[model samples]
Target: MKPTQRLISTLAVVATLGVGLTACGPEDDPYGDGAGSGSGGSSASAQPSKKPAPSDKATDRADGPGDCGTPPKLPAGHKMVEPAVPPSKGSLSAKDAKPVCTPNDWIYHGQGKAKYYLFAQDVKAELSTGPGRTKSVPVGQLWVHAGDCMTNPGAVKAPYTCSGNIYDITLDSEGQINSIKEIWHP
Candidate 1:
């Protein structure tokens, strides 16, 4: 063959061998255990790269102030009471005949450590204190227990039973929650 043709043939062979060798390296190993190499050492280093298991740091972040404890049990013979006024079919207006508390007031007002309230739909509060009722109550903190009833108009005609501890809360003049006491639960 001509000298130029012979040189071209040799270059092509070398290029093919280079690609074949690269295809067999550690990059091709799916397990990343350096199984492709006879010495079992990673191409990048003597040791294989290791990833921590998900459970390794799970305990580190398991508990926090935002976490809630086991819910309190209701006393024997204690029964959940229905709200004096139930919800109606309209936007939750402060002017509505019934009292309505905003959801997540505890988080926004920085009340108690409980990260979340249970029956969000059942909570309600009056815009102003009613006669014979303390201003702090219904306007401050209202407790709701499991089995307590609420009306979610247009959804269910009958009163809806709460499944967990819920609280109706009001913010203080400073936009802070007044309390987080558990008045009732089941």
Candidate 2:
């Protein structure tokens, strides 16, 4: 490949873009994309993204603000960046939304820690891609329960186990994920 072309490809793979929050603040269509008929311009149920997990440093809760406690700690050699959004007519604000407190700083997957930040109650699962919701996966000593991915409603931990590592997540205005979809891959 030409030097210029290679540079472009490298740059392209690094670029991650997201839709911005609407100024409607829960009063209109999401990002005004006309994807649903919920509201002309409402806060819209959370948002989506292609970016590597949106970030806020994980921290120990103290007398003052430190971190939300859910954003995963940066494993060595991993880069975590904020989500980017294009200019929009308006945007919603998650400034008032209280982040759910998590018991652990990192979500342990099979044998290692997961790189994604999980806000269990705030994200939606998109199953059209052939990935189903998990009842809850055992992470470290805590059970990672997601009500959106539950088969048996109200169950804290389902017998099912999460197997895949590929996923697509959307981020909210505060850099927390709002939606997740499992991507099947080989």
Give the whole-model CA lDDT for all candidates, comma-separated: 0.29, 0.30
lDDT of 2 by residue, 43-86 (tens): 11112121112232223233123222232333233222211221
Per-residue C-alpha lDDT of model 1 across residues 1-186, encoded as one tens digit per residue: 699999999999999999887867543544544342332221111221232133332231132221111112233432222233332332111110111112111111112222222233333442212211222334222332211234332332222223222333443344333332222211
Error of 2 at 9 (Å): 52
TM-score of 1: 0.19
Q: Give the Å error, residue 183, model 2.
A: 0.8
Native-vs-model 1 lDDT?
0.29
